[model samples]
Target: MERKGESRGKTPRAPVTERDSSRSPKRASGLSREVVVSATAVKTANPLAEEFDLSASKSHGQEPLPVSFSSPPLLDGLRESVLQALGQSASPTPIQALSLKHLFSDIPEWRQYLLASETGSGKSIAYLLPMFHHLKKSELALPEPTSSTISSRSQRAVNPRALVLAPTHELSRQLSSFAKALLHNIKLRVLCASRANVKSTPRATFTASKMAAQFTDDADGTLGMPHLGVSRPVDVLVGTPNKLLEMARGRRWDRVKDETDKQLAAELSGSRSETSSKSPEPEMGLQNVEWVIVDEADILFDPDFQESTRTLLADVAAARGQPVPYTPDLLRSSPETSTTSTLTQNTPINYPFNLILTTATIPPSLATYLDVHHPTLTRLASPKLHRLPSTMKTEYEGWTGGNKDADIERRIRKVWAEDSIRSDFNGKRSKILIFCNKGTKVQSLGAFLEGKGIPNVALTKDSGARNFGNNHHLDGFLRTTNYKPKPKSSSLSEDKEPHVMITTSMLSRGLDFSPDVRHVFIADEPRNMVDFLHRAGRSARAGQAGKVVVFGKLKGRGSAKATEMKKKVGALRK
Candidate 1:
């Protein structure tokens, strides 16, 4: 096991070369020729840059067509029902405003979109509005279920037409919640893949026979049910890659220990595809997926998830016996003959799924992968994609005082002791978020702070951790903040809040923090420019004032990274 600061030997990599904007990206590693739209830097006088205007610019001389945000049409492309559900939070973020046209349009040329924007820029809504719009259109266009043709289509168990893959369990849940809110009254069921089971709050009405046909009680007597039934089809499935695959292949709900349960599982699984009179139908997951979206693209490209990620993509492509465009030998050479044989054999090239990949930071590796896998990915980026918002102020606190871990802690202590932070707090419990490089450091630093009488909590993954467990300590820590108790829970004044929260980079990407967060501290130096930006982004969200202090030397590796950080921040500060 590698320690917090330990390093695995770096793999030798090819030398890097600078490319010009006029030239297309290199087609390396099985990359084929396809439409490529690279990111272009644009500036505007307004804080939120104007939406992309493709109307030939009013004869190229009429002042470039001023863009405005007005009311009668608060947002375009969304139906009135969706707009009503959004309520007061209906205004489009910068990312949403630019992408909505392509999202809902049926144009043949505008199917795939790649979003690279900052955290909290509303990337979820960008893809979701289009997805829901498509689903709604499909729902409306289908003939009434009274018709035998329509009934057959509806009765064929719930094969999700829209699938969303997230990197972490938390991110998957967060994305699913947003989707459910937007889907408010739409006759669609959202499914989340959990360990050994699928979760869905049955929004669509289903007959008892149909429900019983699709599920069976496990050994624990709890129903291990599939997300969809004959009466209702799942419109959206949001889950991590592994769990999503398990549901797609019909293995997550298998309860062979119970004879009745075994038969029910087989019946539900075989309903997707019928082979012969004697042979049962095969369970082809994702056979009907029309839209497959991968969120947090950079994390999915990590070494740990690379192989499973590739296999999942291959399976989706081959779900309907379609010819995969770029099937690598790694996918075909697997020792598991059953899986490999099914994935490689092709009947015809039927590409039913369009891919949408989004991330706050696009590393070079990810950019290269896009060049190969999603050659036609239409790149749309926020003007502030790589920069901090104007409301966020950054302070560079170098390790000038000392060079050891103790020195880092002392620097942090000094910053919290500053009168300016106190002034910002004004005798209220300080809403501060501290970030560390690894999980172990998060726990250690959190315990250290608690030992120093600064009440705190650690939110890292469970290891030897203790505070996150059920106890009075967490309650006391919550009292220090403005956390309100849920309805019908124990009644208390609810004024207490923790002085500080120490956590790992897991919270850096897409999770929303409380609006009261006024300050952020980085206890350990981040590995990349993207890490730094996301860490600082946790605060100053929803148009609030926030400050971030970094405790590290702005030299050596930090020097180049800091320079890039400054350049990006300066661009948005304009």
Candidate 2:
């Protein structure tokens, strides 16, 4: 019998390989090559080399180009943007190369991909580059808007061609920034909609009325053009789920029409008109969206966010006139039946948009969820998915029964002292990241470290604590040693002391810290291997040498749990 979560006709996960010769470029001697202008001379240059037919070259006698195993063949515009964003000498990581190969293929089979790679492995660029390339191509194929239609188009409802959803506002903003960077040469417009963009307000008091008003009064005094400004139909939208959901559902303009009709009726009858009790219809902007990316898929699919994510998917499907795969109610009642029945009834569902789910780690729950819900998603995972980087060293400190705060303080000092001795320390303070399981612990530990004269910043899910954009201390700490912040009388100098950032797993998934963060301190035992991997992956990123110090207790069952965790970590390395 098959597994409970496994579907009957699911495609087996396979390693990414070049597609058929008709779609993919022919590889000579099992290597991909691209022609570029070169002045270097070749001693035995064969004008008629079998491996690389130089006769195809426009030039009469150009040398055989070296095979590029790192950089995959991409569109000219995308290639330039990639090199520009990641430096000319930099090349695509393993995940990036494989993903690009699959995405760049001309196979028109309604592709859905789940790109799982190790953290800091350029997953953002891997998806962003191809999405941009495809969108740009589509835009070019369309006829230019006439002068008469330009203004009308700008005032029309916001309809983005591509949408990227992130779990947190921070990650969403970061993804938007990266997307903007990739589009530096391209003309596509990238917009980020998150709570961060909205003015900070109490969640309970911020109702739909306030949101509608805010969106109305903000940009040119228009209704739909307020929040995002519909300046030009957004090309690519990056936002958190809640924010994107609101945008996708859109606002009700029928209220104005109802008010006008009621006034006219009152004038004609010389009496008040009964209010229309009909539900206001929503104008959807996601109808034209061709690409939908859910970054950090594991977190979004968790129970905490699963409902909203499912609703968003259903809304997108509805907008595109496709059958709803699974409603929230159906999933709650019977997920296996709802998903299987919806998908199996239709042998192949041609979704209007391509769905791409990117994550650093895929836990069993997420795996089961994907297999049951989206069995057709093609997975492109890296070889180093669950493993800790080889450059990262792990150290465990056990506390039998003592002041945990004091123990943490001592370890912080020890790490600082050790960092001071490094050859590249150069009298500059190093950065440390501390992960805690709870927000209360994060705050208390931050206060304790401050009392101990250790400069630190606390980041939590609380809106007040998460305003890192305005936190100069966090800005200074995350900046490089050469970074110079504007002078402030009350600001603590970042260079004078070692900076430690105390945060929950909120910063663990896709956020990138500075290279100065050489040490990661886990104040509490991670709940699982995925948590541990993400926490440790924050450091030792991009081939940087780093260390991880995990603190645990030795009393009662703590010792056994700690040992088991260590073994799991070791197994991941293998």
Candidate 3:
């Protein structure tokens, strides 16, 4: 079957280009570099590589990894649910297809993998499908419990079977939405715990009882027996690392309850007393997690999130009766010289649960980190992992110093006017994404564009974008607009002008824009190849053609910076 984004019939394999240091100029130290492959190389040329246009390798270089194109027969209900969730996409993308092969295989080592593929390649579905299938299978395997056993288990704390972690609240919510769609026909429940959700709801009203009611199971045990007394069990838990860490650590509810009761009594009697002490309760729910998927591995592993992420992973290991594989000190030490007390070269360590890390690009540092820390991690990479989409056209404009903002405004007007006359315009206003290096620039540029009579919206980390929630400006900008202007309604008509969104790098990764976004304007040069790829990837998604225009200064120190960025872009395109 043909994939959703590709053309009809078979696509011929493009030649792979390995990175040769002799053929290119030397790059500065500490900058991560990846081998360049053609974006059109969606078919494998090597016989050993097999189907799905994927290359399977090991971090430790132990042996040739096996490949499979066939997917095991899924349960009838699950198969239908998966197909329904996929919607018009009848077949899996290359990455999803390859991931299914290993996910259902008998090999235990294949359980742990690093899924590296380009943007818009259906990475979320690649992992979610297998996760749902496995969780369902495990549920069906369990025998019916007795009435007494049900009562006892219901009193116990919640222990989720699957956990998905994302770097941001918006990404976590998106992942949760996809998972919920997949489980629509099935009885399984998916829960999302994020700061956004918490902040939007009242603390008193956001109790476990209220959240549990939303996911309560019906009679006949279709949704599986509830682990919590009043709430349905969570099959999959998706959230940000900080929030999940807080949930996993739990709270001292007994002490809080005692303190509240004492305070009420004292209020009635006009007396004061010391608070009571109570032992802490068990964790909210991570003890029984079977599968842990870390989305956006690069961001999650960085210094900003490294500590919390490591602590959470260690907690999971401890709960699963396995040794903690990663620690701050261990991560700092050289992998060649570092040794674990629980692990030896001669011993084969058995992990209790499957761990999957997914990313769009595999930088040198990330590659090395995984190799040393997770030596047995199976690598599943698409042929276009580090390459830009073949259909994207990039334009570089030089800015020679003064009046940079004016220059950008003129360019925006030109692009907007050009888009207004396209044959496929369909009378609806097109959208453009303008990316800045900092949030302050985003605010200033957004205000400048508004003053220039352009309809625009700005989204920064603190701007509360939250995927268009509560941000009416962003909502109107992103919404479909094709209304006819009424007579004497020139102001209303101006609101329907071509929409432009100004934002910082916070919106660069994992956010999917509408097809109307055909142009990406980089107001500032990207810091690195990874940043450039993600920002450019905002357009030309799902095999659609798009354009990226980069504006850079061409004088003084800016000139040198622009020249260097130009070479990097050229290397990416090559």
Cα lDDT, all candidates: 0.53, 0.62, 0.61
- Residue-by-residue lDDT tens digits, candidate 1, 409-428: 56545645663467655644
- In candidate 3 the C-alpha lDDT for residue 263 amounts to 74
Error of 3 at 28 (Å): 19
Pairs that collide, model 3: none
lDDT tens readout by residue for model 3, 305-410: 6677767877887877776555555434344455756353213323568888888876544554654455556666655676677878999877755777787888
Which residue pairs clash within candidate 2?
A: none
Model 2 TM-score?
0.74
Evaluation by lDDT, superior candidate among 1 and 3 = 3
Best by TM-score: 3
RMSD of each: 11.8, 13.1, 8.5
Candidate 2 Cα outliers beyond 4 Å, as residue runs: 1-73, 147-157, 197-230, 250-284, 329-350, 463-474, 477-498, 555-557
| Per-model TM-score on C-alpha atoms | 0.66, 0.74, 0.75
Report RMSD for candidate 2. 13.1
